[model samples]
Target: MSTDLIFSDATKLAELIRTRAVSPVEVVQAHLDRIGAVNPKLNAIVTVAEGALEAARAAEAAVMAGVALGPLHGVPFSAKDSIDTAGVPTQRGSPIFKGRIPDTDATSVARLKGAGAILLAKTNLPEFSYSTETDNLLTGRANNPWNYDRTPGGSSGGESAAIAAGMSPLGLGTDLAISIRGPAANTGIIGLKATHGRVPMTGIWPRVPRRNWHVGPMARSVRDVAVAYSLLAGADGADGFSTTPLRFDTGVGSSPDQPLRVGWLVEPGFGLIDSEVAATVQKAAEALHGVGCVVEPVRIPALEQENALDIFWRLHRMEVKPAFAAVTAGHEDEMFTISKAMLGEPDTALVDFVRLEQAAERLRDGFAEYFQRYDALLCPVLPIPAHAHGLAEFVINGRTVPATHSLSATVPLNVTGLPGLSIRFGTSRDGLPIGVQLVSRWFAESTILYLASLLETASPVRDLHPDI
Candidate 1:
């Protein structure tokens, strides 16, 4: 019964609790037990919320009293350590701020708790949330539950690992470039990088480059991500960037009035993609077509010309370096590899930075034009499945590229402020998870999320969990 409870998605868990078939205490305790069993092996959860059971007890009392409950009442969710969690430790995977606890919860965390989700734990991340793999001197490294030797992608790596390993049913993860989607793809879970600024970045780190950073949900099912997004996607006044006053719709499994026009791409824009990964993108396109959507292979020339990954690195390094330097000012020795490497890079030249900004505008313009013709874009989440840990470079389709190339497929969405969702659609030749990215125009999270739900139902590898 504990095993079944642990693996159930947040939506199902909420329903079970709502029906009084399960008590809030049982749900929270099952996750706590699961965390105790698997977290030591995965090192995903760094700090367990001491008040979790207390909160659960309160939820149970409410249920017994026949009081109204929120949508996620009694459901346990985790957050990436980079996200502030009130009194809980949010070390940001660095010793510079070790034992740091915030006085207020991040907007994302506060929203989830408002919906009755209990904060269960804080997950790990790369130092200062700035790397492709999850590791830091503060918490060591987060191992993939599928294959301990490989990584669950970074920044959000711990969140993905925790959800995929059934330590938490749903969680919050922040994305900058590839952080959220890459890790979810690595672990066979689903992650949403909602339209930039759709979810407030208040209380998250490194606010200097706030335009590219996003906080969204990572979960085992599409419906849960949609539910979380609906609650999270409004202006929080505190975050200036989150000023979108649009109404959000949790449109899971909903169809449009007409056939949704879709496009898929795997090359000439996203850099070197593995043949297997490329085929998976094609397969996803075929599946969408099979489901009565108009799908075709397409490409955007600006993406190929601007190179979103290059633009992201050039712009963010200049913008974020000072923030890191200031935070690590006297505690240089406490910095880890990812943060140190980021600090080591020289600042973007004034002329080059201006050009990159212009280039980013062009990329966004290009996506705007493409979306006029297509409702959604399908692409590979990563060039390859989760690779072995500590890789500095990767060889894909007979071409060797820097490790940063992994950001190619994802950074474009960040550059354009577009919405994207990562869902497992295929298994790699080596038995690893391969995810496809679904993208839509700005503030159209409902479209991509609805499309993801369709693909989730049509997915060949749906509901497959790691044998941890």
Candidate 2:
């Protein structure tokens, strides 16, 4: 019963709790037990919530009293360590901030708690949440649940690993580039990087390059992500970027009025992708086509002309380096590999910065033009499946590329502030998970999410879990 409870989806758990088939204490304790069992091997959850059981007891009382409940009432959720949690240690996986605790919750965390979800724990991440690998001096490293030697991707790698391992049914992860989606792909779970500014980033770290960062949900099912997004969306007033008025439809498990037009691409624009990953994307496109949606091979010329990966690195380096320098001023020796690497890189030239900014605008325009004819676009989430830990480079399609190349497909969405969803649709030759990315134009989360629900039903890898 405990095993089944830990593996249940967040929505199912909520329903079970509401119906009295299961109590909130049972749900929370099941997750705590799972974390106690698996977290030592994975190091995914750095700090378990202190008052989780107490919160669960209070929720049980509410249920017994027949009080109105929130959509996620009695469900247990986790958050990446970089996201602030009131009274919980949010060390950001760096020694510089060791033993640090925030007095307030991040907007994303607060919204989830507001929905009556208990905070289960805080997952691990790279130092300052900067790397594509989840490792730092403070928390050591997060191992993949599927294969201890492989990574779960980062900087939300630990969150993805926790969800995949059934330690938590839902989680909140922040994405700067590939942090949320790439990690989800690596773990064979689902993650949503909603339209930028749709969810407030208030109370999170490193506000510089604020336009690129996002907070979204990671879960085992699309419906949980959809419900969490509904609760997390809308302007918080405190975050200037989150000014999008509360007016969009969640559109989960529903179809548009007309047949949707979708496009899929894996080459020329997103760097060199593994054949297996590309084939999975092709299969997803075909699946959508099979469902009566008009799908075809397409390309966005801007991605080809202006490499999104290059533009992201050039612009973000200029914006984030100073922020890193400021925070690590007195704690230089405590800085980790990722923070050191960012600081050591040469500054972006003024001319290049201007050019890259314009190029980013062109990429947005390109997507805008494409969306005029297509409702959504499908692509690869990562160039390859999760690789062995601590590797500096990857060889894909017979070409060796820097580890940063993993950001090729994902950074473009961040650059344009567009919405993208990562869902597992296939498996790799090495028995690892492979996910395809679904993207939509700005503020069209409903389209991609609704379409994701359809793809979720058609996915060949449904209900698959890692044998932890």
- Candidate 1 — which residues are off by over 4 angstroms? 246-257
Per-prediction TM-score to the true structure, in the order listed: 0.98, 0.98
**TM-score, cand. 1:** 0.98
Worst 10 residues of 1 by lDDT: 248-257
lDDT of each: 0.91, 0.92
lDDT of 1 by residue, 116-221 (tens): 9999999999998889899999999999999999999997999999999999999999999989999999999999998888899999987677989999999999
Which residue pairs collide in model 1, if any?
Answer: none
Question: Across residues 1-468, which tens digit of lDDT does each residue of candidate 2 receive?
Answer: 998998899999999999999999999999999999999999999999889999999999999999999999999999999999999998999998999999999999999999999998999999998899999999989999989999999999999999999999999999999999999999999999999999999989987668899999999999999999999999998999998865764333324557888889998789899999999999999999888888899988988998888888889888888888998998989999778978999988899899999999999999989988888899999999999998889899898988889999999999999999999999999999999999987888888888889889999999988887
Where model 2 places Cα greater than 4 Å from the true spot, the runs are: 249-257
